[model samples]
Target: MSVVVAVKPSARKRNAKVGRLVAAEGTRHAFGSRAAAERWAESLSTGDGHVWIAAAHPADDDDVDCYLVSRATNAKLEAAYDKRRRRLRGGEGGKQQSLGGAE
Candidate 1:
């Protein structure tokens, strides 16, 4: 499942004190601090569900992109593998478009 923690200020509340938590599935909640929101997201990220905390909406991004941004280390690992794979595939200087391209 794809989970994202949207930390944005409540527009309905005048001069909101903290950020609000909005899940990708439309689940809404409020958090007193960014740390609290991140913590909540981390809690939700367990077992099969890899939670992603985003301050802004991932409007143009696909699921894989969103999932990767959630974990920096995982993204780095993927990049490294992609470089090696591209080198084996005879990509330009071992740097192709990316791992999952249309071609």
Candidate 2:
């Protein structure tokens, strides 16, 4: 089953309660794997925005498994995203880094 990634605006002081999360325009995507979905969600997360992951609910087959991302995970995702961006922009040796070490 495919996983979905969605982005929405975060709750602010003026809007203490976040509204129902509906996938905004240009902010939803599907991936073949949970890891890929999480990575995409993390890349889109920002101070003013929130990201979520959804999958097929294990308990109820017709239900969706969804949750808001934690702040700590967002931080880690941001770090990885930045590192990737830098590498793409030639900050690294412009050599594609292998996912497996010592390749």
By TM-score, the best candidate is: 2
The segments of candidate 2 whose C-alpha lies over 4 angstroms from its true place after superposition are 5-28, 47-57, 61-103
Least accurate 10 contiguous residues by lDDT in model 1: 11-20
Residue-by-residue lDDT tens digits, candidate 1, 1-93: 333333323221211122122323333454665566667656655442344445544585532222212332345788889878879798866
lDDT of each: 0.44, 0.50
Q: Which stretches of candidate 1 lie over 4 Å from their true place?
A: 1-26, 57-103
Model 2 agreement with the true structure over 18-78: per-residue lDDT tens digits = 2323322343445787887676555545444554454544674433344334333456788
TM-score of each: 0.32, 0.33
Please give the clash total of every predicted structure, in order: 0, 0
Q: Judge candidate 1 against the unseen true structure and give its global Cα lDDT, from 0 to 1.
A: 0.44
